[model samples]
Target: MIRVLFYSAVSFLLTSLSCSAEQKRALEYTVSFEHRAAHYAEIQMVVPTPATGTIELMMPTWTPGSYLIREYARHVDHLHATSDGKAPLSIQKTSKNRWLVECPIGKDVRITYQLYCHEMSVRTNWVDRDMAVLNGAATFLTVAGAESTPHRIHFDVPEDWSRSMTSLVAVEGRDHTYVAENLDELIDSPVLCGNPVVQDFNAGGVPHVLATIGDSSLWDTAKAAADVQQIVARQQAFWGVVPYSRFKFLNVISETGGGLEHDNSTLVMTSRWNYRNKEKYEDWLSLVSHEFFHTWNVRRLRPVELTQYDYETENNTRSLWVAEGLTSYYEDLMLVRAGLIDQSAYLKRLSKSIEKLQTNPGRNVQSLSESSFDSWIKFYRPDENSSNSRVSYYVKGCVVGFLLDARIRELTNDARSLDDAMRLLYQRHSGPKGYSNSDFAAILSEVAGTDMNAWLAQHVETTDELDYQPALNWLGLRFAASKSEGTVAETKAATAPTNEAAREVKPAETDETPNDKREEPRAWIGIQTSDGSASVIITGVTHDSPAHEAGLNVDDEILAFNRYRVNSRTWRDQLTQLGIGETIDVLIARRGEIRTIEVKPVTEPTEKWNLKPVAEPSDEVKARLAKWLASQ
Candidate 1:
């Protein structure tokens, strides 16, 4: 009778299951970070439901948009776990990236682990004496079985720290931490910290904050604030609307190549600017403006394929050049509108980037869609042949932006431009349901009153380089093109090779195009790594460098270079002994595999060392250029 009762209960439970093949379960977590201990934090999680299947806990190998897997899991330490607040739950490492947590099959499990985390990385969990820098997608731990279930993270921050910046949904009581309903949202958010000097101001009657760093006082705060204020104001004035409730400017105090945009905030890495270099300062202001404009463009006003971002794969869209490139054009235009940059400087910047794209080889290998789609690998982790294999969507896209804008202005008789297209995009696809590629072209046609098929098919789809002549002529501008090597005589030339058997000799000389192939590489590549201490480790062997010919191998930590003791203070002294072709005996430890390789240095450098921008301004171009300048 008992067996009959059990069978009936099992049948009823099975019949009651939801029609939807239940997506896994979620693990709830509370993490407490103490600033006193630089690299330690406590994490507690309760895994509920779907206990029968194996769960895979993962940390993202890389961040979105910024390609390159850093293997973030290597940094985690002391990860002890449990079930239901009790010690000793069975967990095993299944792979470098996965952990299998064994529980009573289908049983609910609770866990807690203390992570010893320490790294100054922007995309991983970092806790220092200063503040915590958390990128949840790469740092948070999920149950192996609950990777699909909705999860939560509650943060506990040190009381003395006043401000934190992120767009994540914050728990009501979590002091310094935030939450993500699912893993996707967690991947998109990066939390900023360290008593961010918060300043609130109004733009277009909407509130925004310039979350300055402690070193922010170095700049003329009033000018920086006014720059952003007017850019926002001009955008609102043009679009006739403001999309965000508030905006945050995370002014990080680091030397940077550029800024990345977020929904309500922009994480900008930059150093102190000079009050004297007003022109350069204005250029930077335009950079900040570009990122701010992205809030509407790529962030909300997105392509259909990009609407549902899959953190696991590339979010490719054919329209990024339009989205990002158009934004770049507007960023400068906004500066012109705000009277920050003169029209001439603005047009010159545009002309320069356009010329660069047309001259690059990679433009032939990749289309705009392919560029956007493969950005996860190509755009960020550039390589020796990257210039030959890819084109920056930023450079080429902006050219298309200029041509489209000019065409729109000329076609509409100065009444409308890309700005109208953007406003329409904001109206139609601003809140969810991003625009499709076809929809964008339709809008362009509506504004211009002409079919943009040939232009789109040629420049956007096919690898045909953009022809900016007709567009430039529309504004009575004369396009310019020049090639002269003598213009940059002051810049160092790429050294010629003394022998034929060495590395490929850099080009002897090339045409005077800004995108000319003769520029020097950006770094010195001889196989050596530095310990935080005085030790110099031979980490790699260049193919045909003096080190490779001299028989140097990997893991051979250096002892001395040319008899100079390579202590911390004497490191630079050792590097001086090996200037291009000057050979010296290197003493090293190849993991206690100590050896020496003597290499001869050549008189000519093995590489090019610097790059300069070439100018090609011409005559008929001068008139349209004058009008553009006058507009600014």
Candidate 2:
């Protein structure tokens, strides 16, 4: 028996050494969704290798495009390794998301693991009886130092679930086999498996697919498809070329809001009723356009820091304002260009962004570059102080993009604009090498025929207030604010007025009617709440507001309002019940002490900003607007 054992071990060693000499490397990933109802997937990977030492594999901590680190390795379990079915291979856990596999040189190894994927988001993976959304980063393992090696994926799904959708091209003559040039490409392509409404269209002579993974009864698929196709064609024309051979949009209508852009596709999550409402549906289309534009802006013309990604750490850069913000700026502009929305509607959206910036006190505290750099910590994790301390690069960046475009047009007599800058940047750095922050300034100057040093200093690098008038002035537009005031009816719990008496209270003898105001005045106390179950806690207090003036502190839990019990749901109603200028007692628990504070409700002024064309314009201004709007 001992002689037989020795002979067997010798034979296995010989086979491994022979395999190592060939130095052949191949990755075959088999994913099974038959047990998806249990919120897990069984994955098997067969790797043929030539390495003499240990093979290290790593699971990415975060997916690209999503700034937050999700620690996807935590969801992986039931890990086992084998070598040519000869004997169990030695595997060691090296780090939180890394494993070292002991392999005799040239030996073939197989790794089997189960992944729990209950989370539902564009960047994460999810599975259920009905459908599965698989993000490649969260589902695949990367063989350290072998990222450039070609890999193939095979899906083993239930017989009933026949449909599958992904941006990856399938291997010819291989059933369910898809090839990725490298691990990065594999990680960029997400797969959606299950029954879905799939629609195909051609834009700019490139094939496009729209796969909706939920109930599609409410949406007019044909109309939506045509609109989407127009957006694609318009963007293709704007960029002057289509980067990818084919593009796909994987949409999940299980919830509202968000999308993550990829190399050749984008995963969009939206409300089930998004199509039923005109505004919601327009927002959806804007989302689609936003992600598609990213195919050029970030996916190709990326920032220097993102040119080569390190999945284990954050790829922070001060240029996301251009990556994400510029994409946002074009979302609505592309819609207008595609005739999905009129110029008037586009102005409304732009005006809305201006209003948001003006209202956010954080705009004065955070620079666009700082906002982009700290996105990993600040942008994704918002607290009450977020509004007061940090501005959104997205909101302010779009405003800057608008101003930049107008500045370029103004300088060149509409001969060159921001589009010229984009084309130049794309031409120069459309690959593995990304542009730096200074590079953009240089490009903008070259396109505008002027020095942009001061422009970058004042806007991108500092928190100086932006003056929209200059840009608006050049575009034959003016920013105007009109004040229309209204009085709020007072209601007292002890001596509450009847409905008739409430009507009798005159609205402070004003010429302004209810119709004149764009938005009705609301009683402002300026206290924001955190997510709570039993009682609402004050998470923030706006500066100089009644809540701040009355000594309301963040983390103070509100127990009652004016002697009445109140929680998060009832607090807003309690405040709205009181009339403007009315004082009420607020019972709050602060530092283990209960106290009553006198708080008065006041009518707050809500500013309405609009960028309207000048009532009468000079011929040059009119010509600028016409030409600007007419460009791709």
Candidate 3:
């Protein structure tokens, strides 16, 4: 009897779910850009009502991928509701992001509102005379309890607008309509409308589109599409599977910056002139690679805390070090693997990341986990003391990923690495089920063939200094020697050949003089300054440095150094003339008052984070390095 009752209950649950899905399919949204020049998007949503005589409509407070409570409802204006028969209904504000509607039971309600879309960002909405970029979270309002229903959206493109683009599945036989499986899918897809230069390509047997939105006369669309194709193929090879049937790269060349990842598409903003410069173009490619990589890391195989998004509030997690940091580590590496850059370029980029992490004092104050957890409060909202109190999960995570990769290779006798661990983690916990920290550590242990929990704890959960020796040794790499006379051990370690067959690999010479050969160290005040109209303005004072100790503050305009007038161009040169330990009077304007502060110059810290190939490397080590960097 009990078994029969259980079967009956299952049958009833399935039937109810089917009915709910059917009811949700009734929800339809229509977006029109009637006032395109004024940057207002008219939104009309027809929602199916529940058995209750009242229903609530809500707008998300923030978008995913970009972490911040943006309060999207603030953009909504002049909202009204009406019954399906066109009869007016009473709507009242229930909360900041919700609206209560009194409607007839079992009747569909039509909600109409105007959204101000002047914010030009990847996660928000922007509409002008020429173009429109709409993010779902910042544009749509859905019925409260019917979020799981299929949401169909129709775009009423302006008559002059050429086209509209989105990753949402198109409705058959409809002019400009698309359908989403649920609210999550709706929010994950962004729409771009205008006459964009569309370049289509295929990767891993899947269709992909690159829609460039701004001026294209100077942009190389063909070359960019081809490079992006290479990135897609390489990343697909790394993951060994193509998760999305079709993908889109929404490249808005609107003189902006940033990229937000979606499941089947990515919205990236950049300047129209980025393609002209080699370094700037490479940076754009890296941004593309970073966001595309998220198709697997954060968009799918995300931290359990982020597995289910709470759009109204912060969804905190301690594993962004893996989601964002590991992704950062692989972004540039994947670029090299895709043949977009050479090993030297890759090494230079990696060296910069190492330099950034090593030079940051906050690395000693904040752990990787803490950095990830406090990102909502600290990372996005930065202040003057941020550098002294916090570290970027992205930078530190990238360094740790490098070290972890090398350690895994060492533990497994060069047979396995972090790549293997990531693949395994994805295989086990890809869909709705997300992995925890212990699960990730266990995967790493399995791949490395050893216990890695303690190491992981030390690097992720505590503020312990990271040991870079193991990775350097495994890859036959070392940091470049500085002039401070303390890099002898490093130089010897890099130059000492172990056997007759070992080849000596000297550091590449550049135009700059060798640090060790310089006559004297440069003087530093340790205060970053910006150019003001009349004087140099101090932007930031390094913690515990000479400038900080001298009671110098940020925003102070420096009128003179050592009683001599100085401008932005001559301030650094004048400061450099001062000898170390020499006390100098700095004249500054503090909120319109003149003051003089005595500051002693100090020897600038040596640059010890530049990475280079070891001076001596065995054939085995060279082979390992080759394998690590070789194209897949």
| Residue 497 of model 2, lDDT score | 18
User: Taking the tens digit of each residue's C-alpha lDDT, what string does model 1 give over 1-632?
Assistant: 00111212323333322111244334567767753375877777777744364455665666654545566667666665555556466778877666777666555566666666665444555566566666666667665434445655666666766667776555455565454545665666667666776667887656677766545656776667777888777666666656655567766654443676766677665666643367667767877888888877887788787776554445666677777778877787778767777656666666557545643557767887778667767887875455557888787777777778778877877666777777887778865688887888888888888997776777778776456556645554443321223334433222222243223221112122222343532112244444476666554444454555677666666787777668644554346545644567677777556667676644322222122222343554455444443332
Superposed Cα RMSD, model 3: 7.1
**What is the TM-score of each predicted model, taking all chains together?**
0.68, 0.87, 0.91
lDDT of 3 by residue, 1-632 (tens): 00111212334544554465575555789999999889999999987765788988889998998777889999999999999849999999999999999999877888899999998999999999989999999999988877778888899998888889998877656878887778998999999998899999987767899999978788999999999999998899898877877799999988889999999899999997899998899999999999999998988898899989988899999999999999999999999999999888899899878766765667778999999999988998888667778889999999999999999999988889888998899989887899899899999999998899999999999987677888888898887776565554447433222231111111111114444676677667677766445568877777777888899999999898878999876776687696677999999999999999999987666555667778778999998888888734
Per-residue lDDT of 1-632 in model 2, one digit per residue for the tens? 00111212334543543354245444779999867889999999888754576889899998889898889999998888888756688889999999999887777888889999998899888999888899988999868887877677898778878777887767555666676667888899999988888889987666789988877788777788889999998888888867776789998977756899998899998877889898889999999999999998999999999999999999899999999988888999999988899888888888878766766667767999999999999998998677778888899999899888988888887889998899899989888888998888899988888899898889899987776766877887765444442222221111111222121111111113322363555566776677647678877776556787898999999998789999876676577677678999989999999999999987654443456676678898788887777686
Worst 10 residues of 2 by lDDT: 488-497
**For each candidate, what is the lDDT?**
0.61, 0.80, 0.84
Instruction: Give the C-alpha miss distance for residue 201 in model 1, angstroms.
Output: 1.1
Model 2 RMSD, rounded to 1 decimal: 11.0
Q: Supply the global lDDT for candidate 1.
A: 0.61
Decreasing TM-score order of the candidates: 3, 2, 1
| Top of the candidates by lDDT | 3
Candidate No. with top TM-score = 3
